[model samples]
Target: MRKITFKTLTKVFLVLVFSTTPSLVLSQVNPSPKPKSDFWNHVQFGGGFGLALGSDYTNITVAPSAVYNFNEKFAFGTALQYSYIDQENFYKSNVFGGSLIGLFNPLPQIQLSLELEEVNVSNTYQDFGEDYKDNFWYTGLYVGAGYRTNNVTIGFRYNLLFDQDIDLYGQAFMPFVRAYF
Candidate 1:
């Protein structure tokens, strides 16, 4: 009968471990193939909506937007906006527009954005006993920053093209909430 010594057993154990370690490392380094991702998988859709109503006033807004994520840090998108406003015996207005958006993320929790917008405004106002109509096109360029979490962002933006005399948005600074899925 033969007996194995502790030193001999330790040598055998070490040989077994060293022989299998390379295969284990190689297997992790060369994993199985994965399926390719689809184009739509990188596209996200989101927007904003608002409604206000009173005895003498009514307002409604709809904005739909979409973005294509090029990577974890960059995205490009577009948005369409429509708004209707009516004030009893005062004025009625329709505003429609579209915008181009570009976004960047410096950190997982911070987002920066640039947007260009063009809108057409048509308004009818009651001047005493008569109606007056005005129509025009307006353009806006905005730069913004926000806090981001998951698919939602809370931010404020400043319009570079805003004019106090024009009264387009009444002010250059605007707060916004954005989300995407």
Candidate 2:
């Protein structure tokens, strides 16, 4: 056989590569389209409410919250709180505020949380037939752990910034029941 020149061999090699590359690439291409993302599918809404009535006292509370689940184990959320209290002849007050919360689940049944809250308190105190007003803003940072079920969690949180002089809740520790849907 006649000697194959280097230029001729190079041309043959390039032709083989160019002719086979398209078919090789096409064979590996995916046929299915990717699914679109749905934003609302990752969001959950829930909160807490309370009402108390007595001969000399009345209290009502409403707190609504929503969370965006990043995955099965992490969530970030926000909440709005409103409370009305009337201690008959002593005082009447309105507390309104909002909070930012972060939650983490290390196990399916255990949850941990951190929250920062701020509230505006407006109080009218009855003193010797005179009405005295006090208005202020209160801030709290809380860290907590809880037992968690599918949509409910029962736990207690301790406020790191609690002050008895403010007397908002009168204590540094508070119990909470939370649910989400």
Candidate 3:
């Protein structure tokens, strides 16, 4: 649909803008001779595939996230994720969520983050509930972690559905590659 196409375009644009933020900072740092700690303040963008634990199909999301350190060990950022999955009942769905992630970089090879997200879902072959309710309205919380380097990064995430009554949720483990600024 035109709307989904527009939204996807907007996502790509914003990711490019945010992912370039550190380049400006890097230029400043190069002239100033800043410490290695300045590297952690850079921006990160990641893309990869996720294996949906419960369904007949796997999920894939391209997420671009950024962080600004209030200090060396602590940082805050937002992640925008878009995903699609297939189910056994001939149901297919697309999801979008925004999360506030608290980032921890204990070592150069590892990064851990705790996230709280709101997710929205759309089912392609069936209605979400009995009445359809506009074929939308899904929200949830997600907690995830990541390990990264200059070449690639591996990530794992677990989610809890807060808007649905069945107490159902899902887990996604993703191995992604990212380009850093």
User: Distance (Å) between predicted and true CA of 119, model 3?
Assistant: 1.7
List where candidate 1 sits over 4 angstroms from the true fold.
1-37
> Which wins on lDDT, candidate 1 or candidate 2?
2
Q: What lDDT is obtained when candidate 3 is compared to the true structure?
A: 0.61
Per-residue C-alpha lDDT of model 1 across residues 46-130, encoded as one tens digit per residue:
9999999999999999999999999999999999999999999999999999999999999999999999999999989998979
Cα error, residue 154 of model 2, in Å, equals 0.4
Which pairs clash (backbone N, Cα, C closer than 3 Å) in model 2? none
Report the backbone clash tally of model 1. Answer: 0
- Candidate achieving higher TM-score, 1 or 2: 2
Cα-based TM-score, every candidate: 0.78, 0.79, 0.49
In model 3, which runs have C-alpha deviations exceeding 4 angstroms? 1-41, 47-60, 86-89, 126-136, 150-152, 160-180
Would you list the rank order by TM-score, best first? 2, 1, 3
Clashing pairs in 3: none
Of candidates 3 and 2, the better by lDDT: 2
Cα-based lDDT at residue 49, candidate 2: 95
lDDT winner: 2
